[model samples]
Target chain A: MNITLAQARQVVAGALAAGRAASYKPLTVVVLDSGGHVVAVEREDGASTKRFEIAHAKAHGAVALGLGSRALMARAEQQPYFIAAVTQTVGALVPVPGGVLVRDADGGLLGAVGVTGDTSDHDELAALAGIEAAGLVGQPD
Target chain B: MNITLAQARQVVAGALAAGRAASYKPLTVVVLDSGGHVVAVEREDGASTKRFEIAHAKAHGAVALGLGSRALMARAEQQPYFIAAVTQTVGALVPVPGGVLVRDADGGLLGAVGVTGDTSDHDELAALAGIEAAGLVGQPD
Candidate 1:
């Protein structure tokens, strides 16, 4: 099933709330449909403006490559030139841990969520929290 | 005060509601802070994937030039080359009516709201409605 706008909002809210609860730096959250189109995005009041673009790029990279950004990070380490080419081709991409794939119970692709703030690992945890809050599974790898 | 994520979401919700109430096609709404950075963006399910980019460009142009998109459209008609050059320099800009400048009571620039889906006029109207719904001023011209 496709992720609806409502669910996307919930994901964003959950991610931000998680960040706040963890006392992380202000976070930006983006939810992208399976097609890599933006469903919704929210940048916290004090978050750096660039966080929005970074968050979107993370989600876009995950959806476009059909792999969680964590996996992409590993690939980038093994094939830096390839990841660089892909980033150039995609306009914007960040091979990092904060981008997570969303799936249904049967492992159907739904969409993806990207969170940015604090540490990358903390960002990924918030993303997973958001996906679960929206009743979807988050695949970080 | 700056436009918070909460207010940006309100603006997007208001714009989409306005479009639906007017029986317009699916719409994409984007909110940009005064720095021309994205604050929030939402694309309706049926909106074309490109709508997000269009909407962001519209708002970006407004925030970048300190003029509403309707005014930009007029300038474009008078000096096509200037507008074209600016678009190229800015990387992305839409000199159309849908981009609206947002302001506070004292005429302080707060941000901008952009909407894309229906006719340019309808899009501008929706953007205005959204700004008003969020208790901010929308300068369409």
Candidate 2:
């Protein structure tokens, strides 16, 4: 269930190409290893300076929690206390949109990828394309 | 080194509860499993829809890379191409603030969580609370 840096790089490259094909604005992307370690990272031109932070935060959340950011949103609605405690304990977590989990063909977690720049949905699409290019599977909602 | 769904739920609940005590605005919280999969999620009332996406992306990036979103942000400043490529690959990834990694007492990989709505600092505080509530250690950048 380990992920190679080369594979992560390929995934990011594929995703970037897809974003370009869709005429998306500048963006930032990141990949993390199975141990929740950074394998590769990139930021597009014209992306907001803060986007780097945003992208990392979202990606970090996915790998740390092993779930999409959207799912977290639903939980927050039901319980505010738990969410607050988590925020206080984990300084890096941001429960927003635009992050996805990365898994291997055998359903093993290889890592995760996150994108920022355009809408969350658009970002998810670009990530999906990148995962597909890498011959991997993106978790379905 | 696998995080269970039950653990993820506990972390989210704890964090949200902490936020409410502080009377913070609405928030979005997310938790990821050890394999970087979605385990649990929640969004507080008044939180923008985008918060959910941003929070998850940030957390995903943090755990995937084994670094805090803050560090990832700094790296992005130095490496734009890499970041851009990452955004292209992972649609849900955003390298912003508010993501954290969840680790067990033995420093084993547990999971990650992300929160949004308030300031990045506040969001992080909530995430920390969640991790602690789950009886796990939240990596401090």
Candidate 3:
């Protein structure tokens, strides 16, 4: 499955709009394709300088592992060394709550979206909004 | 002066627009702070898997050296071993023409932008466009 550039834009805009609508701080959002490559990214005004990088890392980790970063975060707690190895393998993987896998209606993996520069819960919520806005399923668990 | 996240997004958007306008193949654009850290990145759909890495390498080389990758290319010709060492020194410094130094109106270094997925000349042009669109200067040399 592929994410068109237009859809990628919608994901970024949707994420930003969700953050704004929720009254959260400015955020950065990123989308990665199935192969764990960036498709699009954006940082809202006043987002921290590192927000974009964090967002990308979270998305990369999720898509590369075929699981949401929240799952990774939980696994990391059980096996720190294994998680570190996974991070090394993925080269920017972040086992955190803000990354969610993007899947099609048929449950085929499309990609992932990540959000940063706010509370982890808020970040996850915005990412879900982004994925849904693009007509994709976001696994929030 | 510090480069704001908002301006970083501008650079990313401008670079992608330049690539589209030039009809270059799908591209990946990246921005790095002077400290060799990611600010923003984007890879167009259908772009090669390595485009984002190559783009980031070029940008890191430019920001770290305080010169365009074109200059680094020329320097590399005179000292091949040194350039290779430089590449190792910088995590992802590709001594090629795709990277351009970013500067402010007062000539203060801000960061750099790199473009991949096209000819070196075309990549340089896109990176320059990104810098210029953000009202930042790109030192092509």
Count of backbone clashes, every candidate in sequence: 0, 146, 0
Report interface Cα RMSD per prediction: 1.0, 3.7, 2.6
Off by over 4 Å in 3: A44-50, A88-90
TM-score of each: 0.96, 0.51, 0.89
TM-score of the candidate numbered 3? 0.89
Clashing residue pairs in candidate 1 are none
Off by over 4 Å in 2: A1-141
Q: Cα miss at A14, model 2 (Å)?
A: 30
For residues A25-132, write the lDDT of model 2, one tens digit per residue: 887888877656677888998888887777777677777678876665566678767666776765465565667788987888887788889988888888888889
C-alpha DockQ for predicted model 2: 0.11
Query: Which candidate has the top score in DockQ?
Result: 1
Q: What are the candidates' individual DockQ scores?
A: 0.83, 0.11, 0.49
Error of 2 at A138 (Å): 22
Per-model fnat list: 0.88, 0.10, 0.59
Candidate 3 chain B lDDT trough over 10 residues, lowest sum: B32-41
* Best candidate (score: TM-score): 1
Interface RMSD of 2: 3.7
